[model samples]
Target: MKKLILISGTMGAGKSTVSSELKNILPCNVFLDGDWCWDMQPFTVTEETKEMVHDNIAHILNNFIKCSEYENIIFCWVMHEQSIIDEVLSRLDTSGTSVKVFSLIVNEKALTDRLFEDVKKGIRTEDIIKRSIERIPLYQNLDTIKIDASNISAKEAAQLIKDKLK
Candidate 1:
C-alpha cells in the first residue's frame, strides 16, 4: 500500500540535499542515509568492509518493513553495480512492498569536484574517489530514472524527479 523511493548516486551528487527538499512535498515518508550503513569508525573502503556494506543495507531494509509508524520510505545511498542494485530491489519488493529507484549520475569532472569537496569535509579520500569515477548505473530497467546531477541545480533536479515520478 506504500512506495519505496530508493535514491542512489555518487558522493557529492546532492542526493541528500535534493531528497530533503523533495521530502517536504512527500507524505508518510522516512529518509535513510545509506552512508550511515558504513562503519561509523573512520575507515577507507577496502576488502575488509565490502560485505559489511551489503549486509548493512539488507538489515536496514528489514527494519523499514517492520516499522509500524511509517507509510512510505525513501532509502538513499551510493549505488555502483546494477546487479547489486537489482538484488536489493528484488528483496525489498517482497511481501506486498513496492520498490522504485532513482539514480543520480554525473561525469568524471563532477566526480573529481565532488570528491575533492568530500576530502575537505572528511567523508572520502583520493583512493575512494579514484575507484568510483566512471562507475555506471547498476540497474537498467524502465522503472529507473537516471538524472544528470552535474548540469542541474538541486531544486531543478528535485523537480525533475518529482515530475518523473508523476
Candidate 2:
C-alpha cells in the first residue's frame, strides 16, 4: 500500500520548503505539491468561500493521489481545522493506506516575514497577513508531530522528518 504523508502547517511555516527537502531525502518517494491543486481557482478572502476551500482541499488532494505515479506520497499544504484534517484521515483510514501527519510552525514574526516575501514574489496569491495569522494558532493541534521551524533550515527539517518516519 502507498503511504500518504501529509505535512501541513500555517502559511509561511515552511510546508513547501520542508516538503521539498523531505522528498529529496526519501528514496523512491515522489512529491505531490498541494498547491498545484489550485486548478487556477481565483483567490478569495470572503468567508463565503469557506466551503469551496475545504472542498478543494479534499477533492483536489484525493484526486491527485488517485492517479499520481508514486505509491509512497508526501504532500504539503497549509491545512487548518479538524474537519478538513479529518477528511484526509478518514479516507486514509477507510482505504487502509498508512498515513502520517506533521505540522511545521514558526514564530509569528517569521511567518509574517515569509508571507511578505511570498507576496512580493507574487507567489502568495492572497497577501492578506491578517487572514494568514488568524489560521496559524490551530495547525499544531491537527498533526501527530509539530516541528518548530523558526530556527531550523529546510534540510534539518527534512532530516527530522526522515528520522521520525524511520
Q: Model-by-model lDDT, in order?
A: 0.72, 0.73
lDDT of 1 by residue, 58-119 (tens): 77776776676666677777766677677676555346666668888777787688779888
Give the range where candidate 1 is weakest over 10 consecutive residues by summed lDDT: 134-143
TM-scores for the candidates: 0.76, 0.77
Model 1, C-alpha of 89: deviation from truth (Å): 2.4
Best by lDDT: 2
Q: Whole-model lDDT, candidate 2?
A: 0.73
RMSD of each: 3.2, 3.4
Tens digit per residue, CA lDDT, model 2, 44-153: 65656655655665665565457546565787876787776676556542264567788887778888888888888998765567787787788767746888888889
Candidate 2's C-alpha runs over 4 A off are: 44-71, 93-96
Predicted structure 1, TM vs. truth: 0.76
